[model samples]
Target: MSFVLGVISALTAPFLVVVGFIVWDNHWNGTAFALNMYNCTMTAIGFLIVSIVVRQFVLEPSTEEEIFTSQKIGGLMVSSTIGILIGDWVWLEGLRLLGSRKIIVVDSLKPFLAVFLGEVFLDERLERGAIIGLILTVLGVALVGLEKEDHNIETETTIECESVGAAGTEVFNEHTVLIEKDNNEQSSTVVVDSYAQQRKNRGKQSTKEFIYGLVMAILNVVLHTFGVLLTKKYGVGMTTFEINLIRFGFAGICMALLSFSLWSISNISSTTTSTTTTMTTMMTTMTMKPAWYLLPDASYSTWRRISFGVVFVSFLQPALTNYAMFQISLALLLTLESIGPLYSLPLSYILQGNRPTFRACIGAILAVIGIIVLSFKGITES
Candidate 1:
């Protein structure tokens, strides 16, 4: 049951991220916010929600590693800030500026880039096959990125979307197609116009913001690469959970503090602490993070959705993943998990009811194959 739950968790994780981002954006749509402020606040809220849940429910202080020493905290803080906060900040910026599919083109470079960075910084050895795998993976993603752009079909029904920015430009090009079917004496026109508005809104961006977004994405790759190396160096043999909790726990508090000063929500009204806050042994840890000050006007329904969503994203998924590992080898679990990016295809189909291009699908398959090769190679060597 737990392993099934973990598989379900893995399958839903990507969908959850895309959906959750949309949900949060709707809640905070009114603000012309700084990118860092918005990113850090959301990061804090998500991390704090996870830390609080895990500490309260899953993790026992006595059973877990108490590896939160001063040096560890400091190093993890760097990872937290650089990897989590800053990486996500630039990522969102790129997402906003370039759109998901386009930014995904940049992100697809991560596997090879990480391998290269690891070799340089961590002195990790790489095989020739691994190098080939990395290159092939990038090439596959590049193929995927070259989605069909020309869809100038004229129909009786016209769909229009008020282009907000560059972000929506990246939607559904992978799945856009003209469908024609014939009955005995009539033809049916099936138009998937869900993102019709987005399709209409493509010609709405300056060249400068486009270039800037790409630069930010590349820089994000670098920051993330270094952050992982730093985490390994400074985290001192801590498990993934320990590393994440300490990093998130500490960074969440700091971001909460920053959020307190960034907005006037704290002084506008102070609701009493959450009823569940006192139920944890990590009371001292909880005090530093502001779980609700950022969303003063959130309705109960919104709060419930947001809280549960964060908990699922941060804790339940990882928790189930860890639980699944007990029943499988670590390498096997990782190799199984590495196919996550391929989920984007079926996910796009399920969520949007649109099929990706044949070329893009083949590219995705190749990329996943490359990842499998790399994964098995690492296991074979180690």
Candidate 2:
């Protein structure tokens, strides 16, 4: 069920994000900064809400001074924020442009990149097997990106009827119908040639987006690795829940401030033409209304759904994963995370009825193998 939630969160969170950006872009010309800030702020809100609810109902609450005063906690907060901000923004961007499946596969490169970073930054020596594993991992990701997108599978339904004629002769009639149910949705009939052409065009666009997503995924992996390292280094004394709370709280505050500043600047610049306009804009801005930050064109229902997705993806997934992290070694944590694609791919098939191409499956296997090799090496060295 957790794995299913992870898959659902991965797909749904980004979809809502892409939709929010699309609506914002169409209406108010949204910037990437705004989108990043929005995501961070909302994520922070989700964490805070959960924390408060848990503290009130399930656990005793601790003082902010106790959590924030320690030097180690402060270091963890800063380092984790750097990692979370960069990794999250890049990941969301990848999701927005490339889609969930492709982005998830691309993210499997993290362990490989982390190994390389370790060799460079920590002066760690990589075993020959680890080096070979790294090579295989890169090759697998390349193959995945290069594999052709699967075509829509159509299901044909046939019906036959027979009737006896007045002259005692048997009359037969037959009917055939073709229906394509994609992702559990029935699609309207489309001409084969035209559909093929459309798919080809879409494939080209998807290829371009995949390349872009690949780069972003790599950057995300690097930043996320750094963040994890920072947490491991400075997070020895604190509980995982406390560290996460501080991280989220600090990050949320920073993003909220940045977002408010940007919003103010943009509004001020736009409203400089007339005193009346300035006054009205100032009043609207001073109110610190959600409408100023959120998409004006988006409906209440859209906001509610997006908020729910953000809560699940941002809060619940991380809470579960972080709790698990406290119980395991970093290498084991990473090795487990590296299997995200394996879960995502199969779950997509079961839930959406979208089958992966053969090449994709092979690529996922190779990447998993590479991560396992790296994990084994780390375990032995430690």
Model 2: per-residue Cα lDDT at residue 40:
50
Error of 1 at 188 (Å): 20
Instruction: Return model 2's CA RMSD, one decimal.
Output: 14.2
Model 2 lDDT tens row, 280-358:
8778866543443343334676566545544544455455556544443343344444443344455446644666678
Segments in model 1 whose C-alpha atoms lie over 4 Å from true places: 1-66, 145-211, 265-293, 316-341, 380-382
Each candidate: how many clashes? 1, 0
lDDT of residue 277 for candidate 2: 81
* Candidate 2: worst-modelled 10 consecutive residues by lDDT: 169-178
lDDT of each: 0.49, 0.49
RMSD, candidate 1, Å: 12.0
What is the TM-score of each predicted model, taking all chains together? Answer: 0.61, 0.56
Q: List the residue pairs that clash in candidate 1.
A: 161-197
Cα lDDT tens digits, model 1, 174-225, are 1011111111222112232423444355436678877888898888767765
- Which 10 consecutive residues of model 1 have the lowest summed lDDT? 172-181
